[model samples]
Every structure is written in structure tokens, then in C-alpha cells.
Target: MKTKTALVTGASSGIGRDIAMILSKKGYRIIMVARRENRLLELAEKLPGESRIIAADLSRAEECFELYEKVRGEHIHVLINCAGFGILGEFEQIPLGKELEMLDVNIRAVHILTKLFLADFTAQDSGYILNVASTAGLMPGGPLMASYYASKAYVTNLTIAINQELHSAESRVYVGALCPGPVDTEFNDVANSDFAVSAMSSKKCASIAVRQMFRRKMLIVPGFSNQFFVFAARFLPRRAVIATAEKIQSMKREEQNS
Candidate 1:
């Protein structure tokens, strides 16, 4: 039996960490990448199988390429781009510099890493790539989280389009976009999304994602309720959906303030 290798970004915590752990348990050697060196080192030590930690801030383009170079000789069977960040507030109120940083990490970095890995996977014509988008990608969110929604939308669409192209080329590569809603991770603390109540656990979410990846599913919206909501958002009028999101955000703010 051969040990396959999986590269999981943002693996220091939350969904990425869980994904790395689960992959390791399934007999895959894991390469955990994140900005938090201590957490990544701790996770690598605890994983069931062989693992390594690459502590690089993926927001930097050079670091993204550096990671690719770091594991050049290894055969990467899976590449999971779970590294991203979000900002919540009026677009104008958010600092332009902060918005650029969000785009750099969430959109640009994802694209860079995906492109780099896809070249290798395409050459072999067999591998899996998972891009973690959010259910917020399905529609426009309220003014508070506008840029974050747009970035996720880009991820969702890009993943689908790439999957189509791969199929057309008769490549065995599988590309999946994971669109989960309000997951119970450290993400809420960073995004300041107080509406995240009874959210799905990172462990549960990653388990489903891993299972679906091997099954070659193109898009995975984890929970049934979340899937239903995404479908509804797709069919609803844009204005109506935005208005509803505004109400939800307002209620969330009240909850946080109280």
C-alpha cells in the first residue's frame, strides 16, 4: 500500500485542520500549511499518520509559490485550498487596504495555489482539488459583507468552470467547490458574523468534504438545510434576497450588542 500526499492550506485550525487530520487517518501523508507555526506544528505532531507543517502566510504570492517549491519532489494526490478571510461592514466603511488584503488572500492566493497545483494534476491527469467557498456565494449578501460574498462567488464559478474544462479535456482530475454556510469555526471570530448559531462543526464538515472528494462530486453544499437555502437564494429576486439579508444582519447586530 502506498501513502498518498495531501496539501491542506489554512490547516492550523478550523475546517482545514480537521481536513488534514481526517486525511491523515485515511492513510494519507499530510502537508499542513498556515500562518500559525505553533498550531501547525502541534497539529502535525498529533496527526495519525505522517505529516509536515509549512508555516507560510499564503497571502503573500512568494510564499504560495514557495510552498509549491517546498514539496516539489512529492506526489500530491490532493490539494485543498481552504485558506481565506472575510470582512464584515459597509464596503465604504471598510479600509481600502484591508479590502485589498482580503482579496489578496481569499481570491488571488487561491487562484495562484490552484493554478500551480492544477498544472501538476493535469500533467498526471488524476488528482483532486477542493476550493472552499461559502453559501454566501450563491447570492449577493447585505452591504456589510459585500466583498466577501463577491470573492466567494468567484471561487464557486471558477471551480465549476474548471471542472467543465477538465472533463472536456478527458482528464481524470476532479475539482470540487465546497459551499458551506455559517460553519462553527474560528472564522466567525475573524469575520465578526455573530449570526452563526448552531453552525456545523468543522470536523463534520471536513468529513463530508473528504468523502465527496473521492466520489468526484463537482460541488458540495454540506447540510440539507444549507443546500435548500442556497437553492432558494438562487431563485429569489436579487433585491428581495438582499433585503432579507439586511434584516438578518440587523438582528445579528442586535444579538451581539445585547
Candidate 2:
């Protein structure tokens, strides 16, 4: 069988970039999407297999439609929604517009693109959808990072629903949610989420996520420690989890300041 094409959003950096590279190495033709045209072009040039650089802000609803149109005519075997960011600090302190943008990118974009591609996938009876959520989505977040957590929670639930629907119908379509802990990426710096110790690398996280995805796992939490924390959060008191997260966030901020 000919290798299928893969579309990865946020393909310019972090986990998204690594995913595109990994899928390409596996002989898939890759379509890289992000707002940075230059970075996407650079990635396209370096990939072993054929790659297309799509420069579009997927945060916009119309752009999501355009993206679907661009690849709808082609054979897309997978869609990876990894274009997301967090704004740290108290919700009231964060700019309203930036928070809304986060919702647009993390939540709305995922929904719209998935809806568009799902129709195609159902018709063909095969495709994979990977939504990059976070460990924060597993629980109620701390004082800071409220909106970010809420958005991820939405992703987690939505991914689960789709996965359930696929399984119920005995379809080959697969959907997985990647709930990783803190990652060592430009995401931290951009979100200003400086911490005492950085988490795993984007490459490592991407590798684990992709592996689980191939296994058709409905959800994946990469690190042992992260899995432990999420498991505890599930049974522990909500206030306790919130307090722990606050302390961790505070320690990170203090370390950055020092």
C-alpha cells in the first residue's frame, strides 16, 4: 500500500515539529501547517519524504475550512492538532484577547478541523486524529493557567467522545488525546511559565505519543511521574490538587526570578 499523507498543525516547533518529522521518516507524505511560513518551509525542505508547507493561522474558523479544502482533495491519513499555547498568571491578569485566542486555537480549531476531516474519514472508514491536550486537563488547574486548563479539559473530553463513537461503530477511524506534562519547548518561554525544573523534551514526548497513537490507544500520558500525578488527581481531593499545582507554579516562578 502507498504511504498516506499526514497533516500536522503547529509544525514549526515543539511536539508538532517532531511529529511531522517522525511521520515523514515513516514514509508518510507530510503537510505542515502553522502561522510561520519560513519555519514550515524549512521543515519541508528537511523532511525525507514529500512535504507541503501551509501558512495559515488555524486559530481562525475560516482558515480551518481553508485548510480542510487544501488537503481534502488529497489523501490525508492523519490529522494532528498540536497548535496550542498557555498564558500563565491569574486569569484576570492575562489579556482578554490573548485568552480568547487560546480558546480559538486550542478548542475551536480542533473541533472545526476534526469535524471537517471526520466526514472524509467516515466515508473512507480509516484515519487517525491526535489532539494534543495536557496533564492539566486531567484536573482542575491552579489559580494561574485557569483558561488553559479549561481549554485542554475540553480537548480531552471531546477526543474521548470521538474515540467512543468510532469504537461503538466498529470503525477503523482512530482518535487519541495526548496529555503530556510540562515540555521543554519554546512554549514555556512564550507562555512565561518558567519553572524550577523543566519537563521532558518535545522529541521524547512526541516519540511516546506517536508510538501510542500507532497502537490505537485512546489516550496517552507519556511520563511515569505525570501518569502518577494524574492518577492521584483523579482520586485525591480537588482542593489538594489545586494547592499542589499552585506550589509548583510558585516554585517555578521563584526559580526564574532568582
Candidate 3:
């Protein structure tokens, strides 16, 4: 049996780390990428199969391309973009510079890596690309975390459109989005917006994402409750949906402050 290689961004922690571990257990050699070199090193050492660590901050566009150049020779069978963060506040109150930086890492980084790797994958006619968006992506709006929501929306819609293009071209390559809802990870710490409700475990989220990606699922949303909520939002009035989003995010803030 041949050992496949998977390149996972944001592999230092959370969904990315768990996915790397899962893929390694499946006998795939993992290429872990993140800004935290120490964490990546520790994770690589713990993987059951062979693994490598590349500590590149995807916020820098050059590094995104550099990562690809460094790994282009490797027969990468899977590419997972999970490097992202969110901030919770009214759109006007949030710092513009901070939101711009978030866009660099969240939207630009994913776009760059996905496009570059997708071309390579399509050329070879084999590869899986999974972009980790949030269930926030499916919603019409996010009052408190507007920028973050918009970033994820871009990821989700881009994945859908690209999947359509691949199908039209009759390509075997697969591209999908994993839009999990409220996964318990360092995201809350960074976003400063803890979930008002129970959060799903990151391990479970990663497991489901990997399984569905291989099954060629275009949009993988874990948990039935989350799936139902996303579906129900479509029929609700846009104004009502936006108001509900505000209530939910405000609850998270209230919980954090309490």
C-alpha cells in the first residue's frame, strides 16, 4: 500500500490538528503548516505515521505561495485549509486594521492555497481540498461578527462554485467545504466570543469532515441540529434572520461577561 500525503494548514490546534492526526492514523504522511512551530513540531512527533512540519504564517501571501512551492514535488493527496479567526463586535466598533488582517488569513490565504492546489490536483486528476468554513457561512448575516461571517461566506460559496466548475469539466478532483457549528476549540479564546450553547468537540468535527470529503460531499455540515437550523433560516424573512443572529451573538457576549 502507498502512503498518501495530506497538507493541513492551522495544524497546530483545533480541527486542523485533529484532522492531521486522523489522516496520519489512516496511513497518510501529513504535512502540517501553521505559525506555531513548537506546536507543529509536537504534533508531528505524535503522529502515528511519518509527518513534516512547515511553520509558515499564511497571513503573508508570499508564504502561502512559498508553502506550495516547497510541497509541490510531494504527491499531496489532500489539502485542508483551516487557518482562520473571528472577532465579535458591531461593524463600526471593530478595528479596520484587525479585520483586514483577519481577511488576509481567512479569505486571502484560503483562496490562494485552494486555487494553487486545485490546479495541481486537477492536473493529476486526483486530490481532495477541504476548506473549513463555519455554519455562520450559511446564515444570511452575523450582526456581531460581520467580517468573520463574510469571510466564511466567501469560502463556502467559492467551494460550491468551484465544485460546479469541476463537474462541468468532468474532473475527478474534489473540492468541498466543512461548515461546522460551534466547535469547542481555541476559536472561542481568539474570537473572544464563547458559544452560549454547548459546542461540538473538534475531534468529532474533523472526523466527519474527513469522511465526507472522501465521499465527495460538496458541503459538509456536522450535527443534525445545526443542519436543521441552516435549512430553516432559508425560509425565514431576511430581517428576522439578521435579528436572530444579533440575539445569538449578543447571548455569547452576555455569557462571556457574566
Candidate 4:
């Protein structure tokens, strides 16, 4: 029996780190990628199975491609796209540079990596790709985090469409979106937003995400509250959903200012 390899982006901390740990325990050799080499090294040292660290800032397209090339020799059984961040502000108020960077990391990186790996997976007829999106992707619009939400919407939609394509082709490759809401991570500090609601722990979220990935679930929304909100968004009027999202996001923005 050969050990399977799982490559996780944003593995320095938060959801990515937890997911890597879970996969390691589950007997997969882990390849951890992040901007912080030291953190990845530390995480690699603690994993139960064989692990490697590839420190690359995935926000850059060339870097993403380079990272793919570096690991193309390894048979990656699972690919988890968890490298993304958000900027909490009105679309117009946020710096254009920052917004573009967010898109690069949240959308472009996922697209590039998934495309590269999906080809390999389909060729071999077995693999799993878990793209970490957010509940914000389910909403029509997010006022304060507009660009971030839009980027995630791309991830969620792309993952689902690819999953369907695989099913239609009768292929075994699994592609799914992990849509979690407010996981207790460094995201709040990085995004500069305050949470109005309680957050799920990163460990719990990762546990559910990994289990669902193995089951080949299409849309893995972790918590009960997040699942309910995603379901409710589908029934609500688009305008109403957008307005409600704006209100909730605005409250968080206000708290950040206070």
C-alpha cells in the first residue's frame, strides 16, 4: 500500500493548517504550502506522516504555476485550496491594489491550481480537490466585503461546475467547495473585521471538511448555522438577501472602527 499525498495551500495557520493535520493523521503524506516558510516547517515537523513544505506566495500567477511544477512529480491524492484573504470595506473605499491582490489569491490561485491538478487527476481517474470558499459566496452581495464575496462566488461556482463535468464524464475525480462561515482563525485580524456572531473552531471545521471530501460531497458547508443560512439564501429574494448581508457586514465594519 502506497501512502497518498495531499497538498494544502495556506497551510501556515487556520483552516489550512488544521486540514493538513487531519489529513496527516488519516495517513496521507502532506505537502504544505504557505508564504511563511518557518510556520510550514514547524507544522511539517509535527505531522504524523511524511510531510514537505513549499513556501510560495500563491497570489502571484507565476508562483502558483511554479509551485505546481515543483510538485508535479508527486502523486497528489488531494488538493486543498485554502489560500485567500478578505478586505473589510466598501468596494469604493478599499484600495484597488488590495482588491486586486484579494482576487489574485482568492480566485486566480484556486483556478490555476485546480486546472493544473484536475488535468492530472482526470488523466489518472482518481483525486479530490477541495476549494475553500465562504458562506459569503452564497449571498447575492456583500456590502463591506464585496470583492472578497465575489471571489468566493467564483470558487464555489467553479468547483460545482467542474464536479458536475466529472460526473457527466463518469470520472472519479472529486471537486468540491468548502463553504464555511466565521471559523475561529486569524482571518478576523487579517481581514480587519469584527465578528458579530460566534465562530466555529478551525479544528472542527477542518474535521468536517476532510470527512466530506473523502465522501466526495459537492458542497460542504460545515456548521448547522452556516448550512441553514446557505439554504435560506436560496429561498430569499435576491434583493432581500443582499440587503441583509450588507447589514450584517456593516455591523462588523462598525465594530472594527469602534
lDDT of each: 0.87, 0.90, 0.94, 0.93
Residue 100, candidate 2: Cα error in Å is 0.3
Candidate 3 regions off by >4 Å? Answer: none
Return the candidate ranking by TM-score, descending.
Answer: 3, 4, 2, 1
Q: Could you tell me how far off, in angstroms, the CA of residue 203 lies in candidate 4 after the best superposition?
A: 0.4
Q: What is the lDDT of residue 185 in candidate 3?
A: 94
Ranking by lDDT: 3, 4, 2, 1
Residue 258 lDDT in candidate 3: 84
Q: What is the lDDT, from 0 to 100, of the residue 199 in candidate 1?
A: 82
Q: Write the per-residue lDDT of candidate 3 for residues 231-255, one digit (tens) a residue.
A: 9999999999989989999999998
* Candidate 2 vs 3: which has more lDDT: 3
Q: Using Cα atoms with residue i matched to residue i, what is each candidate's TM-score against the true structure? A: 0.96, 0.97, 0.98, 0.98
Show the colliding residue pairs in model 3. Answer: none
Q: What stretches of model 1 exceed 4 Å from their correct place?
A: none
lDDT of 4 by residue, 219-255 (tens): 9999889999989999989989999888888888887
Model 1 / residue 208 / CA error / Å: 1.0
- Model 2 ranges with Cα > 4 A deviation: none
* CA RMSD per model (angstroms): 1.3, 1.2, 0.9, 0.9
Clashes per candidate, residues 3 or more apart or on different chains: 0, 1, 0, 0
User: Model 4 residue 181 lDDT?
Assistant: 92
